[model samples]
Target chain A: MLRREMNAPRDNIVEIRDLHFSRGARKIFDGLNVDIKRGQVTAIMGPSGTGKTTLLRLITRQLRPDHGTIVVDGVDIANLNKAELYKLRKRFGMLFQNGALLTDLSVFENVAFPLREHTNLSNRLIRHVVLTKLHAVGLRGAADMMPGELSGGMARRVALARAMATDPDILIYDEPFVGLDPISMGVIVRLVRRMNDALGISSILVSHDVDEISTVSDCSYLLSDGKVAASGSPDELNRASSELVRQFMHGMADGPVAFHFAAPDYAEQLLGRDSE
Target chain B: MPRELWITFVEFVRTFGALTLFLVELLIQVPRVFVRRFRLIVAQVYNAGSLSLVIIMVCGAFVGGVLALQGYANLTRFNAEDAVGIFAGFALIKELGPVITALLFAGRAGTALASEIGLMKATDQLSAMEMMAVDPIRRVVLPRFLGGVIAMPLLTAVFSMIGLLGAHMVGVMLLSIDVGAFWQQMQSTLDLRDVSEGILKSVVFGVIASLLAVWEGYNAIPTAEGVSRATTRTVVLTAIAVLITDFMITAWFLR
Candidate 1:
């Protein structure tokens, strides 16, 4: 089924090895391992509270794994100093769930931010690059608008432009289709595919929307209980034999995932036990 | 020991340690402001300084008038009514101006900075900056810190000037005390040392207030309620820190 590619070579851009992370007493990722191939669109899908976001944060070096190594490109990020980590970050771009545009900056300035911070480009050149990036997202006309003035979809598009402004080797999108209309979702899917092919950059998409995941991803991983329970092409995921996989993929109500919390019998809890 | 008291003591030590580390980080990033972030520093200065002029002026005028009126009443009993100017000048320049202006700045610009940074964190702007390889402390906090430090002494100076004018209006113009005595006594009592002392106090207070505000904001939990709590903490901690700092600086220099 190609579910576990343990023997994959070292050509992958990102590799996680036996990763373990926890929040206080709550374990999130346990002995998890994943590889992201270069110039491919990979998706991480899971039910609610399955640590999809945490995985992205670990890859970005925002949160260190409690017990393992995350290697980006070739360097083990856990050992990188602040300067080295920042230098490593330049090789990647990320789009947050809510777009995360700087509220004080206009759309144009937001797109120009990375260039202004990292490059010594002239103002004329910066303006040229910023407009070109915004134009790619079809938001050039809204360049002067403030983030508060943008619709959700527009803000997401602007964030996309800003993320790609640095022309990073890898792009990470956290919930790209979240809260989007169908048309907007379609636009994002097309853009992700088009940008991946045109820019020849790898992408890691974190989402639970099955349709969007299948449409945009070259490969997919389904995280369950702090582990990748199943991984394959989108079609293979739809035909996964595991009951947990079927429940999540098909959005079943009564399956391995309980509809209620684990508790004593409902009727006994509602009525006090008779005194013995 | 009471559990609450032990908890409070631990919290105090933790906060003190965190603040010390924050100040160290800020000092490390200070030079970057001049090299790459001059425009941001200028904007922060305008925000923290120019926007604060009116409040400082109005508060200074009222405080000076009250001082002059009370000093005259007390000195009248000693037959030293002409000493009103000296009293107002010494009190305003040596003690009241810097301390009161700091308190007001904490309430005004300090709170504003805290809320702004808190909102940015809640909205994931800080994370986005991190992803872009830009350090938020160097890009955001440094400008505000420098701005506060630059603005504090200037604001204190303005406050003292307006206060003296108010004192003059009360002592000389209204009470018909000899104008010559008023100016003469003020000039004789105040020196470059006293003015410098006041400036130094204000600059230190500025650093404390601005740093505390930004620290609270940056560490605030990313939520609406969390941002509100952080803003409240900025005002409370800034006020307390300013008063304590004023006392320490005053003891070291003024004495």
Candidate 2:
């Protein structure tokens, strides 16, 4: 019943409305709308360079939108001062694609990082909390090991442990499955689902692994050309008739989305007028 | 050419303004960092200070011996070989010590700080800290800045002391100058003013070197080439700034 009730209209943990963003002269998001429902794994699926990571940045107020409002739990992050923004960010646990564990610190200390910074927890308490989080990610045995020693998946798991140490209300994964071996991918996929339901917190995943996204996501949005090409249950997206959605879901080499970048005619460039 | 000159001038002003702002931000974060980040600062002192000790000492000894040998040869022309001690001491305390130590600091600790921070930025560790509600400026940058600034004056003092001994080794033991005359000349002529000048120069150089190191590292483009470039810039900028400031400080003291 609790999971079913997440489909209600007013349950969004983050709401983006009429979003507009750009990097220099190039547009990123144009009137994009997205909702991350409370207590569910919502995936933002897109082709590469569609600004999925940028969307995550905007959600956490790392970059301000050109025009539009992002409401994270009824607070418009556009106007938060530095102190206020940091306070708001305490609610989020973000796992970067490369894991981003502090190299100077060991696995345990890396997980203990946020706790040490934000809370005045005793050393014993911090250790307990760190080990607990590490255990949750199945990395308790690797607590004293340095980050450089961990495999990519293990490093990602350690990063996940670090991210969750502060008990954030929202867990964000930025391309979590990139370059992961299938076993590690399955482990991460299971953890993503388990963490969301087990903790009863929201998870916003930015990924393009359609199979993993379909398996783990409660709802998915496919983005193309600065807009949500389609959004619904993965099955619904799979069943959709739109060319962009079909091309992305099926991983077609060429479709409405051309493999070649937009440029001057290839023949014209080859047979240059300058040759005369 | 005019356009290029104008562009260079504009870039200079922009970097100057940015560096000033960065210095101010570190100052503002001072109380917060010092309050709880003392261990981090101490560790950085060990990193930027003790770790750089061997290089600093070796160079100081060699520089002192060279100065003494040269000063003795010059003084011998006028039968004033005793003043070799004064010459070496004056040069080491007032000019060479601070300038050379700062240069070495730039080469040793400065490169370390820049490359470490740059790599962290490349790996997104700094961004991760930011996302976790921890300010990297307070946690990472400020402590290192404090470490270098604290270490510089001390390192300069150590360098001058060790250089005097080096001068003694060459001038008194090897060159066979009258030991009493060499010792007396240095003790009397090398007044508090010379010591103060050395300390002042070192502190200033420390601030400049440390500030530049952290600035280049923090603003480095997050890539291997970028980090390498940041490290190179940290060394180059700090070396140039130390030399220019040495002349300026010496001139000011003379006036």
Candidate 3:
């Protein structure tokens, strides 16, 4: 199935090798290696600030790895110039955590932005395309409304519509289920699967929702300390041997992970007469 | 000595210095910015132009009325009531109209724009735009700047006309200056140079106001609180810049 989706060649749709990123003196992700096969939804699950979003940024070329190679569609994203990078970005869609639609523009205009910007299509054609995409996301009636008016779920869908407006080859969702109610979460997961199937576009879903991840993901990776600590099908992850993975997957708080409270340390110092 | 005062002074310097550096960098990379994102000029024009007509009319009308009263009062004391029309026309076309209109715009659109863009930056919209290969300056700042440029002169023109008319009404109706005499004086004093120079000042004001607002908005840090601070700074600085530029241009032209 992955082979058929690649269509053009055997190369991975998106490949990352030994990618390291640091903010100032602290290293975030180290020697992170991952591959996203064409036509598969790859779920990346990790603890907070373990660099899930950073990984997405690196793949999309919004960030550059200190030392590594990210080849997308057979071209190394690192070497692409500004114009080439722009062209490359056109092939991928990204759903942001907070549905970052332009507040000033109506939903119609928001969705039409990419089409109007990248193509010289006539206004009529652009309107048709925008409405079609909006309808696909079940938001055709909200076209005239501003993004500020929509519910969070609706806004996310609108953003999704805008992301899919350009009919990108790959779609990336950064924490799509964050801050969402269960119903909304279900709707988004279903939409992700539906869109992937309908458009035949490859997707990378980065999330921490274990239940949704298990249900929606074809293959999943456990990212820890900037490396793929473990990776397998969801079923395999359920049967994995890593303690950290098990602790994280079950959402256990009192295992090896300690919740450091500064107050306890201060209290201990005072009670033990260690204070100067 | 108050530490808060010192902190404020330091912050002021930092913001001004950073803005200056940003402007210099913007100037240096202008060619690249333009080449990659020229359509922003059109967008800026549209953003600034839309919804400006009503505010401009209201402000201009009141300003014109006040100009007429002040000019008439001062001129009449000198037994120069005959020059009421001259005072009103020359004052507005040469100086008061453009400066006042721009100051108003700086407060209204400038503050709102800076706050909105600054908040967007805080929320990571700019980052998303960058990821999409969209140039924020081109997609966001350029459109707003161009909009200000287009909107300002039109607003100034409205201001000039309304101010002159208010002066006319004051002179003819209230002060008993003959309509014909007033118009005659206006015809003589309101030369093409006066109109042209006012336009020139307004254009410069437009550039400064838009640049300052957009720059502050673009470089806003922290979060929404940062956006609010940037908005305040944009309004204050742009207002001062408008006043200073107004004086400099007036001195250069009138001298």
lDDT of 1 by residue, B234-254 (tens): 989988888888788888884
Which pairs clash in the backbone of model 3? A29-A226, B43-B143, B44-B143, B44-B144, B44-B147, B45-B146, B45-B147, B64-B163
Using TM-score as the measure, the top candidate is: 2
DockQ of 1: 0.90
lDDT of 2 by residue, A1-276 (tens): 987665554688899999999999999999999988889999999988899999999999988999999999878999999999999999999999999999999999999999988999999999999999888878899999999999988999999998899889999999999888888789889989998998889999999999999999999988888899999999999999998899999999878888888777778788895355
Worst window of 10 by summed lDDT in candidate 2 chain B: B185-194
Per-prediction DockQ comes to: 0.90, 0.82, 0.42
Residue range with the least summed lDDT across 10 consecutive positions in model 2 chain A:
A2-11
lDDT score of residue A245 within candidate 3: 82
Worst 10 residues of 1 chain B by lDDT: B246-255
lDDT of 3 at A9: 70
Work out the TM-score per prediction. 0.95, 0.96, 0.83
Q: List per-model TM-scores for chain B.
A: 0.96, 0.98, 0.85
Model 2 stretches with alpha carbons more than 4 Å out: A1-10, A263-276
Judging by lDDT, tell me the better candidate of 1 and 3: 1
lDDT of candidate 3 over A73-153, digit per residue (tens) = 788999999889988998888888888888778999989988877899999999999999888777899999998899988
The segments of candidate 3 whose C-alpha lies over 4 angstroms from its true place after superposition are A1-10, A24-26, A120-136, A140-144, A179-184, A194-199, A260-276, B1-52, B122-133
Candidate 1 segments whose C-alpha is farther than 4 A from its true place: A1-9, A261-276, B2-4
> What is the C-alpha lDDT profile of model 1 across A1-276, one tens digit per residue?
454554454478999899999999999999998988888999999988889998999999888899988888767899999999999999999999999999999999999999999999999999999999898888899999999999988899899999999899999999999888888788889999999999999999999999889988998999988888999899999998999889988999888877677687767767865321
